[model samples]
Target chain A: MLIRRPPDLLPSEITPEPLARGRRALLKGLGAGAALAGLGLPQISQAGSLGTLRPSPLSSDEKLTPLKSVTGYNNFYEFGTDKEDPARHAPGRLKTQPWTVTVEGEIKRPRTFSIDDLLKLAPLEERIYRMRCVEGWSMVIPWVGFPLAELIRQVEPNGQARFVEFVTLADPQQMPGVRSPLLDWPYVEGLRLDEAQHPLTLLAVGLYGEVLPAQNGAPIRLVVPWKYGFKSAKSIVRIRFVREQPRSTWMKAGPSEYGFYSNVNPAVDHPRWSQATERRIGEFIKRKTLPFNGYADQVAGLYSGMDLRRFF
Target chain B: MTFQPTPRQLTAIKAALFLLTLLPALHYAHGLWSDSLGANPIEALTRGMGIWTLNFLFLTLCVSPLRKLSGWHWLLRLRRMLGLTAFAYGCLHLLTYLWLDQFWDVDAIARDIWKRPFITVGATAFLLMLPLALTSSHAAIRSLGGKRWQSLHRAVYAVAILGVVHYLWLVKRVALLDPIIYALVLAILLGWRVVERIRLNGPWPTRSTPPAVQPVVFMKRDAAAALGVPKKR
Candidate 1:
């Protein structure tokens, strides 16, 4: 109910008014044509409507991971710990429709915006980014969302706001992990202000030309392509700006194994296994992991002169 | 209505267990053939094999104590079969990690075994199992002699313990259910052995057995030791 209306779209926002309206009209025409042309195809998500965001200059041409693989296999520990647990258990278990993200702490405007407000507030973009898990597996995902920088810019972080922290929902009725003490509940994740503002940083709302699957962090999730997948917190409910570095779940759980930055570095191995190579989804042999996950040219300067292994 | 199975029946029982032990491997093979491993098949394959290795180790440990309590001497025969199957699974587990997961990256694997505690413990357990697996032969048993061979095989308890530690430490966030369940089962199995030992030896002090009673206890101890060492010749 709260995620369908864009009543708060300000005139000064990023997307120009005329262009936005024009695109909507084009999408409508395409949807109508699609329905009329074939077996009256009902699904028109791929009609460059719900998913077509701005084309990211930073994305790759690599083959996109299949939607089924992307949605069916996940590590949203809230549903359960297993990769398939979310797919099997999360369909009707969690409520995503009336989701709201509370933006607060050291910001000029600290307001709670419903999912609809988020969609209207920021212009979406499609980015085919590499997602590498800390457990040595990789996938190429086509994400649809606006830049996290735009969201941070809208909130207007004060100078004291140094780190951006995100918190996920912790409801036992929906999340089984909340009942189990496997992790400190209300899973928290963070990034430095600079990293949060990076152009590649995304606040994803959809994937594969469709709305985000409940299993894959529906409604809202953060996506930092350069870092391990865990750093990109899913099912985000709150974004708080703070002066000090925020406490992240994995880093809090095992500091030695999971560092705050969590940058994808083959040189620095996890405590239990090597991170030098990653098994891509559907591929048998592992491929060599890249520096900054192959976006070194863009992101390396952000950590200039800092020791990655030490920070990691 | 006797629990004793004839030699032919014993052979049939061993055959059934051997097939049962292959089920995990066969299931993994089917998964591989059908492309059902989902996303990272290698990770699935490696993890599955490693878990089965731990399972077989626990199953092998379970046999002795269960046999002791059940009063089924025939269960003793399945011990070697179970132990060897554990070793086979262990070998496959290591090979999967080495050949498929690491892609024969010997240097990296060497560094991993040396540096990582989980890998180190796992490698140690596998190495300990290796000597027992190698010596599982009629000629080796005959040459090593009963007392020495029995002493050598006693290393199995340590192997099972180390195997559990390796698995427990491997998980990132301590997947409690599997590890805790495994620990409980292992604790019970090993507890049985400990209780049986104290029952025969009496509490710590050696408690000065009466001169006449000592001979009878020594006879029981000798027979038990002999029972542990399988005859080869």
Candidate 2:
């Protein structure tokens, strides 16, 4: 079977060399002002906004999944379960503008904020992270947002707060799948307060430099790097700081299958599927799944004494 | 009287059905060529094979029920072909999981089959299909003789039930739509058979042939009750 590989757009956005991985500040063609100012519109018109990200040390040396494949193949149950369903249903149906996130509960400044207002609340930066889905496929995504910790700090949690719950939008008019009880409708996810405040936990607003495509969770979404992709709730509408663990949608949907922590542990496989290895998008072969999605070095301390297998 | 195709026509129809069985693989090939298998082609491929395997299983199970329902006894001629196609798809699904998925990690494969309930049932269903496929030939059928061949093939109903259970448990949350449909089908197919037995006599396979149709030698006397006809010794 003779097939032609597309010419590499290398020495461009994605560099192969590990040393040049995080040199995204120099590579970003759009100024920060342009990206910030264009947040009001559904589309970001800036040329480089959808191009090479301003990489950081957190970016991986591994290959980057194509933006087309990344956005096209998604598992947003709000749209549908098929990988192509979200790409087909979300773009035209989802209304991203006029979106507001309610940041209430256990916070001193409990108030609703728009996409632009969230920008004002915190600065945006690019961090490339490997997103491993519990389905056993992984992708390295260049995400644009600030640390979720920054927003948590800004909100100022009360001392009694021990967990943070994130709720996704449940509008059947836009998200057709919300009409079905495939999952508990208002898809909820949560993190331990410390996990929410971790430097790696990002409140992503954009991806590949542009504002997030609706299917990719436009406006704002949680991007917890260490957990399975579902734990990184999308199109987040509310953030609740509570004293105890909240009922996360997946955990509630299948308690034994999807645990509360849902961390990326290669050793503990899902009852139906294995977690030992994952097929990276665009590649034929799978690589060994890293513990904590390769951030175990930084995040392992959070679960020091607890048994992951039982919790998982 | 029921309209029946001639032997020549039946052979042609069987050939067509054989080609129809390969349509799913052809559709997958087109998807692979056009790059439409989404971000995860292997996942799509694995899933496609698995779905098709079950699909053929249901089609095979439906043969007897449909024959009984519609009085289309000719449908039985295609049962072996349908069953074999299902077995072939099951092999592909397993091979894809082992080679493309586990990359021949024998230990992981063993652990998966042992640990995963869904995989255990699915593997059992697949393993059961192997003997049925091997004995599908006329030579094996003759060597085993009619009664034992019929007895061995009777296990297909059990295999079909296990296949549905495998699919039902394989999903993350046991989403009922698809699995329930499969279960309902297996239920109806199996239901008709039990009801059929009571109508024939008691729950035992007796040596009986109705005096009403002594010359109806090719009517599969044992299966006649399931064929919606009463037979007596």
Candidate 3:
């Protein structure tokens, strides 16, 4: 059963309460009863009505400092190279009003679903993951979304779905990066079938109990925390399952510099510099990089028999 | 027997100056190893060290031009120190590329330098800096003698051109702004030499003198306007 708040109270419930005693006791009593309605986690449920997935409990922050926050804001070079460019350029162009994703390719259910239908397909969950960038800085973001494999599974990929490729919206009017000849328009990223099924990969739609800001890849974006930031492409429009490796944008720019896998292995250095160390975001000094970006325990099994050096 | 220092106390003073000149270059290296570089440290370190290397190379080139045009013979004394400082920073730049970037893999480093156009230009600049650095000592000057030493050191001219080329090639597209500014500054420094050479060979032709003098006078007139003055005829 999902909990459904009364329409009037829903809007006010998300705010911090000043009238504590009366509202707190009443809200607590109502929350207990409301849990019977089968609604997702109430924290995000009260924030918006996007039919967000019911997220898992907030994860622990093992030994990291308290200074963790979004280390970087988006820098959309199409609008301009400035950090605030994406916020200004993204909102008006990527209107979610008529957003829909065509889930075709080799899937049992080949259907085009509206963005609303997609959100309702699964219970939203939140996961705090460390994001490392190829440029040698990192961030810890508590993102709200569910596993991407959950969505892929619902479509029921065919036996030949060895790879899953994500294609971002290509309208030059919307994504200004498409204007420049720097890359093939409509950025694409892919993961091997098993890699896509990894429990850690997230399909993020919101952060901080609010709808994801336009600059933050609103509606939907992939979050593969262990890899460098570029691997998680933004503003996705299509998903294609294929047999061969898809050409990645950064790798196309400089193959020697950016590899296909791009897993954060400190030992395999980039052509221009070593990946052995990275500056923790918001901190002054760079720390030694850990194997698989410190999530080796969880992801190490996936690469058990293969050589990271060759893949990297 | 050694060629003893001229009454200039050349040995002690030159050594002290050499060590002092190394401080700024050393400070950059310290920042690199300690990771004091801000966000995007790779770029910060790359650009920071790269710009300093070019500046030192430019400063080295300036010595001969300033000596010739300004008739400041004493400026010649600092040429070796300035050239060596350029070499030191060049070495640090390459070291960052080696240890930090290639993880000290000689084969991989060699391949990249050979294959990439920008890296090729940068590597040529470093290789050219090598002999210049080796020949910076008084012993090297004595062994080569004055004429040979001057000819070998003329390689600094080649180094300057290569440094600018490397910078231009690294950036995407032509990006004429930065390279153009550096080119203009270098051309002015080189132009001063050309002017000094023509002046020494013969007096400036009357025709060229009139046109050249007009721009200088016009610049002064513009300056005079700021000072609330109409120049007297």
Candidate 4:
């Protein structure tokens, strides 16, 4: 199962790591200039154009998965169930233009922000996060977005807002898979108010220095680094601040298999499969899955004194 | 419309069918070598092999119904080859899981077989195919006698059912359409056989007496003669 690495170019021809980093910095500066220039103009097409992203120190130094695999392989059932279905069907089928995300319910200032307005809410940062799927596969993706906390601050949720629920777009005309009754439609995911405000939890607008592809939940999506990939709802249209714990789509579909709190703990085996180890996409050997997907130091406190197995 | 081929032509057809069955294996090998099996090549290979095994099983089951409906007796001559191809793919699927997935970890493999319902069902299906594969030979068939051999090979129905259930249980509940289609095809194939049986013998098997007519037995002899094989005299 080992794939041979392509023959390396001559050492003299290769750019050093620091120089490459400097070049990326230069590019970011130029991108910022371009972004400012395009501010007055109408919104750019969703395929490309994410403007500028301020690089974050929080990004993982581990090798990023190839953009091909990141964009190609997806589990957005709104497109279809097959891994490749999203990539194949989502591009043309999904219309992200003139999109507006309504943030309401248990919030003081209920606002419906256009995609453009949402992008400008906070400074976007590049966070290289380890995304682990429940189906024994993992990927390290350089996601470009701002923290979810930024939006929460803007809306100012009331004390009754104990939980946050994310609802994604489900249009049958746009999403063909919506025609099939696969789980409850308009995929829903929720997080505790504290978990939503965590620095690591992001509302991703793009990846790999480009606008988020339609398959990867174009325009905007939630990115919960410590949880299983499904926790991150895609193509979001509504964000609700609720009091009771919201039941996620997977949780509703299979209560025993998928729990509301799907934190990536290697010890917690899925009812149908083991999660102790995960195949890291391109690599042949399975790597040991870490507690909280190696973000235990940052997120372990959120679940302290709670039985993860029971919650899961 | 029926046409009988010469023994040489039949051999050529059999050879062609054998090569056709190898295409799926070759496609996967090419996918592996070219590094085009998406993100997880091992999973792609494993699942592909398992699917082909089910496909061949479906083909094997279709033979009798096809021969009966179309009056093409020679189709039965290809059934054993189809069954064996299904078995071959089943073996490869198991090997992929053992070597690539489990890394030959006996402890993990044993635990999986014992704990996971899908894995247990899949393993049982493969194990049951072993006896049918062993007794597929002409000599083994002669030693066991036609009635006993047929009864033993009837285990294929069970194997097919288990294989479908294994697949259904393996996938996420949302992705049940593919496995359900396999289940439907199997049901129709088995249902055809049941209807044929009812037509041959009354709906109820009253122990009063056996039916005077045995067209199925005669058809097998006719198929053997068509394929230029000596009858069981």
Q: DockQ of every model listed?
A: 0.50, 0.48, 0.07, 0.59
Kindly list the per-residue Cα lDDT of model 4 for residues A1-312, writing each as its tens digit.
Answer: 011122553454233466456435644654543464356321335344455456665667576677778989999988889999999999988898889999999999999999989877887777889999999999989798899999999999998999999999999999988888868998999999999999999999887766788999988999999999999999999999999999999988999999999999898889888888899988998899999999999999999999998888
lDDT of 4 at B57: 97
Q: Which runs of model 1 end up more than 4 angstroms from their true locations? A: A1-51, B207-233
**Stretches of candidate 2 above 4 Å error?**
A1-54, B202-233
Clashing pairs in 1: none
Identify the leading candidate in terms of lDDT: 4
The positional error of residue A264 in candidate 4, measured at the CA in angstroms, is 0.7
Task: TM-score for candidate 1, please give it.
Answer: 0.86
Instruction: Kindly list the per-residue Cα lDDT of model 1 for residues B1-233, writing each as its tens digit.
Output: 33989999999999999899999999999999998987667778888888888788888888887777778889978888888988998899999988998888889899989988989989888877877888878778788886678666767777777788888888866366787788788788777776776787776356675421232244344334434544444
Best by TM-score: 4
Clashes of each: 0, 3, 13, 0
Taking the tens digit of each residue's C-alpha lDDT, what string does model 1 give over A1-312?
A: 001224454444234445445434544565544343244222222322353346666767576666668887889988887889999888788788788999999899999988878877776667879999988888988788888999898999998999999998888999877787878888999999999999999999877545677888877899999999999998899999999999798877888889989999999998888899898887777899998999899999999999998999
Candidate 2: tens digits of C-alpha lDDT, residues A1-312: 001123553344444544233334323444753454345332333323533233466656566677778789998989986778889999878887788899888888898888777865655667779999998989988788888898888889998899999999999999988887768879999999999999899988887666788899887899998999999999999999999899999887888789999999999988787899888998888899999999999999999999999998
Q: What tens digits encode model 4's per-residue C-alpha lDDT throughout B90-124?
A: 99999999999989989988988998999999998
State the TM-score of the second chain for every model. 0.86, 0.83, 0.72, 0.88
Worst lDDT run of 10 residues, candidate 4 chain B, spans B222-231
- Per-model i-RMS in Å? 1.6, 2.1, 5.9, 0.9
Ranking by DockQ: 4, 1, 2, 3
Of candidate 4 chain A, the 10-residue stretch with the lowest lDDT total is: A1-10
Best by DockQ: 4
Candidate 3 per-residue C-alpha lDDT over B81-155 given as tens digits, one digit per residue, 9 for 90 to 100:
888788877887787777655667788677778767778888877876776677678887787676656655656
Candidate 4 runs further than 4 Å off:
A1-46, B205-233
Output the lDDT of residue B48, model 1. 89
